[model samples]
Target: MNGTLTLDGFCHRLAADPLRYRKLHPVAMAGEFVDHFGVPPFPRMEGIAGLLDRSGIGTVVLSHETGGLRGYHVGTRDGGYLIHVDASEGRVGQEHTALHEAYEVMRERLHDLHPRIGLAAGISLCRQADRFAAATLMQPYWFAIFAEASGLDVVALQASYGRSYASLTIRLAEVMRHQPLLAVLYERGPQAERPPGMPGQVSEGLRATVVARTPGFRLRMQRRPLSALRGLLPRRGAPPPPGSVAERVALTGRPAAVDRVSGYDLWRADDLAVLARPVIWGGQVAKVSVVAVPYRDRSVLLPQFANAAFERTFHAHQVL
Candidate 1:
């Protein structure tokens, strides 16, 4: 499939055998695509541009004006593609939009099959391109290594990878599909309601908490008081401790290191400690944190939880 796994090809495959493609991880597929194109690992912005140029995109234009539309891609008279990005959206947003447009341009088969492909197919293709761009920007292997090394801190991972919080949050969910011990929470405001599209309901006067966890881990959390801590879901009763790391980070927009606490401080577990960091969005503080059973092994200093797949993959790739 070298040099041939175009966006349209992936969409066709997904349409023909939805379950098969659904089971495959987006990051892994994107890594394979990069490897096939011979792009360097952990490609930077310039590298991504180069890849786009090679994939048939001719020019990338950035507009500083703020508008309703983030960006768009269009075919020029010369049969080349031009991508226009909204620079006003900032660096991370511009990068994401550019990559998404580039992927759209690379869907050579889509143009050929446009007349035959209906609206549903077109939507699927668009969704596939979005995922492809995200995975390309945040390569799975690099992200996995960074997650482990950075103690699963979303802010640190965002700095290291130069990804937007939204992108990093989505990628975290993708990574959690393989790492059961991993979970990420986004607390929007002091008493923010549950984020739109997130499952479960929050208790009155509580802040929003969107939890993303692996299936088994989520099931285990569900069996306990932490059931409300399920993926992107809110807790059913009571707010977290006011002095808890999550609350402190939300209020102060600062990082906090805390010892294990009782009664909904985090996961309702006595053994788990937390490192909470504020996720700043639109100049406002959004509390985000990483939780894990504290590490007992001398080999690692930070919390080390059991994740066989993550351990095997990390060791095999020498990412740790």
Candidate 2:
């Protein structure tokens, strides 16, 4: 079997013997998933796109008006997958989806190899594979390092890992020298102690004061107050629906989708303000925080940063 036949055969084989094929695959942290697949980690998914391109698959960003739907991966008979993702989610999120699609393809191939193997029948095996892939790609180890380095505690850990939000805060805290922030937040006890909205909505006055007191944190206020959040407008359109991404982040004290602004440091500028710098001892994001920026200001800042902060922060803290 070669070319089209080989591809078809591979898919069929996986479908036939899903268990046997899945068994051979290695599992690690989410970061390892990217590494093993010859792609970059979550926050840097261009590597994944590059890999897809090399395989003759085109990853395009087409508007919904152009018959493009979000969150669907369409595989061409020629052995390529065309993945449509929301522009807002960007490459990191999209790459995770792509990896998921690839895993399905691999599964099909495994089943084809052993027609009698039913991964569906072996629920444990299927679940284990998924956990392995998610854990590997999420790179919890790196996340742990960045968290500790930043001085984050269990409560802060929820912000970094509990939600679907990107995990860059830990790493950014490490790089920015904000371990004390994490220390302070953790020392404050469980986040449950604070009013639900309080932790995520640090005031600007508080931000200024905390940074002022923590000289070692290395945060320099940009000469210009950050470009206001209004800059993210869709050009003369209604603002995002009520309960938008920023709103969610603010309420949860967790990094949310809004953190993926194109230029801002996702970890430092989102709903959770930067009171301190994150540390990256070893290869992960450690504990870090600041006095907390007001929810409104942090909301504004989120539009300018990329998701890199999540991975950077998480990786930095995890090492610590």
Candidate 3:
């Protein structure tokens, strides 16, 4: 392969023969990094976090009285990293956001790897490798086992996994890419359809915009209750609802709106109130969005700082 992996080719390979490639490249990246830098093995998230700390990526708690959203990152003048994660997002019980941030950091470092490929290919590989790594590490089968052993539902999963609704939902979707049970759960969940006067169909542009604008954008997928899968693993917790607003928007095909002011109130209550709006495309709601609200006393707004930075940098090059 010699690291010539094209994005479209990698995606096609993943779709065509997912299992064979599932643990291949990301694991390769890990192996290469360890061989080059002599880093210790990371058997779990905490281990990876520790590795990041040693690699000069600093993890810090960011407190700004915002109530709705979870985690984000800031760059340091010294070219190091500072990750700001909300404690509220932590309440969702999974570590999706943290993992996402960590993946980003990893991608940044991948660019600095020796004998680098062309910029376009290198960046694409880095991001895809991060996704691949995350999917491999948090396989849905493992989640099923964990949920069974621990008795965690969506709410409990949030508690145990330390992930937010959006992150967890997206993670579940990623898991479905490999596991049949998760695939079934995702397929059987409620799906959204557009109203007659709405957009005709969904598009990638619409999806990106909605995701960019929404808070907790990850939560729009249907989640499976851990309690129902007891026989597949071992049983543990009470079940919660299976679907989220993103899933609902996709299923109902309706454009939804959220009042950020009211959302602020919920946020101030420390409830991590996430508000979502739908992006209409081709006569349908193409995507659902979520954003964390600041405290009740504060004004509701886009995560301007983070969003602006992401918009400026994300996809800066056609290859990335």
Candidate 4:
């Protein structure tokens, strides 16, 4: 649980204390499963490693016979389950399917034990299995330790982890959820229409999604055109739109600032700054991560405050 995480070390710990994880959360269970058996995240996994040992998985049948289905969990007459993973799918896809099917098989058992659980819960359980799959690959416990030592150097971490930019940033947001900050993702895509005649048309722009935040920090007016951000500012003095800088950063896909945000005024900062970086995916700027950067000097210039690696990483694949 300290320093660099390793598959062998994690397995040793889990084996040493099996009862400790007997009643684990879904996310934790996924992490432990991958940690215990070294399930494929990036590098290729040997023929169905983790799923083979699971009791719930009666048999892992690799087939394209499920009528184009990548993976399917089928229950037998003897009340056993068979997980069919795609024979044509890559290692990563297979890993996800296997984990998802495994969770689904277990969910079926839980429902049988409590008939009142309801069919509506099946959809929710499936969605939870998706979460479990994500957690299995990018375990938060390991990610937290890695991020801390690396100064939350996201660019390096993303490359190392071999995950999508959004996945890495969103996980970073989750890791910092209890701290004094607001982590948001702004993606450039087709804009959704506003309430009729509500605003000037700015078709095709960045749309913001709140990834995670500390309990104290809140931004109700988070949107494509952050015009309502004016209300979030202190009313004592006539203030400019706080959203301009962030909007520009999202639009331009760079680190920028309007002015130095006063300490403890916005984002609950003693020494912090708004740092935005382009979330590059497949050689294009698809999204941006706008988050608070912990810094000593409040007067540092816009892009200079941004990490060199972070800045350079996106600039290679500039704004779309």
Candidate 5:
């Protein structure tokens, strides 16, 4: 992403360097930017701004939004672009918007050249731009570096990385962490009372709202319709069993690792084992993060989970 690079000429570069670049996907393109520019690990606003500048795009942070739009970009007569992000979205949201608008503005250039395009192409382009934004903002190579210290603590990662829960978690899933780990982040669906000692807690009955995992790891008997992710918790599922470790963690932010000699399974799956960790914000359990691994036998030893990068090993099992 050199300052000379222009949005209008992006397609031309793809055509000119077909052999060098095999795919036109935005995620791949964003990766190219990350690699090409040597974007620093754990980038922040200044870093992202540098990226935008390198891409020949001017930026403006507006205190107010326009027509409910969080961000938008416009082409300049000088054959470059200028992106504007509304400050109302907060720091994290603004960073995301800035990166997202950088990709989204490319669509305007494409549409200008081709007055009309197929419906599918337009939809595909938008999706690609979204992916590009995410991939660029969160460099995958940094995962290993971050994990070395904090492990795969999603709450800490989300906060430290300055990303939304859904964005960071989904990016983790997409990048495919090295270990065979699947971490699901979820919130309580309904409640009775905050378990004793867990003050300010509001709810019970945990339900998965976001999912992140290494490739191919899944719950047994999932239908995987539409998308493999939808089948994870919403389909053919129930809340973690009452008195189960998951229920305990959800009700109370205490971590749990238990061996099911003949105990509870979130859903009746023979292979689904779990370890529940509470994600706390402001001293209340905002949500729970589940680290699942495949293991069985009387010992209930979690040898398979050694590489999952938890700060401490999980002795038991979990559900999101």
Candidate 6:
């Protein structure tokens, strides 16, 4: 377990034998750790601290000068771990950092793998540990239940999970794997700089949009030729209609009615309609997630009418 392994190599090894690493998945592994200490679902600050304490993390300190570090773990004199959190990062950030550090500490104990002390290996290790932290904080099964009951509203998800937008979005993608749905994350950019083939650009305020779609949904999108009907990959310049859901949502941060957008949106199918929700962080629209159910029955992924609407909308707005 002690050697130089690139992050890519480590991931490839896990992918090669999924069964062996099955227990290594962040959610599954974190659940095991939580269960060991009888931690309940949606464990908050105290519960997380308890998990850290029981995982050989001896002390948790909040520091004013993290030196640009969000969190870090050091070996204690008695061979335990000390986790330091940057208090300036706020509560959510501190929680995420603590959990991530605790996970790495526990991982080293459970697997008997020596901690990578080298800077390069340490950086890779931290990245992998961060993924685990996200899964642990979000708790996939619990989040999936919430998503099913409440739908995929990014703001609501953040509130319920008590996690940062970035954490929830990353973990949400993992939970969406078993479901017949797609979850995407978009980074907002300026309206005028939208590249050709991007679908969700708006006027004046919102610019670059980054959409992260589920694997299955992305594949389905690839089979379609319509630029607007595909995933957020930039295409030859084509703007959605002025009053379309993409346009309205991009501009106003308000979701267009599902029925109104049923046949016209890329995320919607004949039977399964996608829901678009924006994640606003730091007083700006940082990301938008589009969740859609995958194909279940034999029907056109993109109907001719939807295609016609795209053409009409494109033509109508071309003069602008």
Candidate topping TM-score: 5
* RMSD versus native structure for model 6: 8.8
lDDT of 5 by residue, 194-238 (tens): 545533432354556665667656444344345543313332223
Q: Residues 1-320, candidate 6, lDDT per residue (tens digit)?
A: 22213222233343445473575666665665554455566666666776556434546888887788997778877777778888788677777788888767655654444333212237776776777777767776678877655555555677677776655666766776755444444454445655555544454344323234445554344466776554343222333334444455556565432322233335554234444455556875665554444334213223322211222221121111
- The positional error of residue 181 in candidate 1, measured at the CA in angstroms, is 3.1
Local accuracy of candidate 3 as per-residue lDDT tens digits, 119-218: 2345575455445344534455566555444222233344565543344444544433322211011111233453344444321122221112122222
Candidate 4 colliding pairs, count: 0
lDDT of 2 at 151: 36
Two-way TM-score contest, 1 vs 6, winner: 6
**CA lDDT of every candidate:** 0.53, 0.37, 0.38, 0.52, 0.57, 0.54
RMSD of each: 9.0, 17.1, 19.4, 8.9, 6.8, 8.8
Model 2 lDDT vs. the true structure? Answer: 0.37
Candidate 3: deviation at residue 28, Å?
7.7
> Can you give the TM-score per candidate against the true fold?
0.63, 0.36, 0.35, 0.62, 0.67, 0.66
Model 6: pairs clashing at backbone N, Cα or C within 3 Å? 184-212, 185-212, 186-210, 187-210, 189-207, 189-208, 190-207, 190-208, 196-235, 197-235
Q: After superposition, how far is residue 6 of candidate 3 from its true place, in Å?
A: 27
Higher-TM-score candidate of 2 and 6: 6
- The C-alpha local distance difference test score for the whole of candidate 4 amounts to 0.52
* lDDT score, candidate 1, position 182: 37
**Candidate 1 lDDT by residue in tens digits, 209-232:** 544555434323345564354432
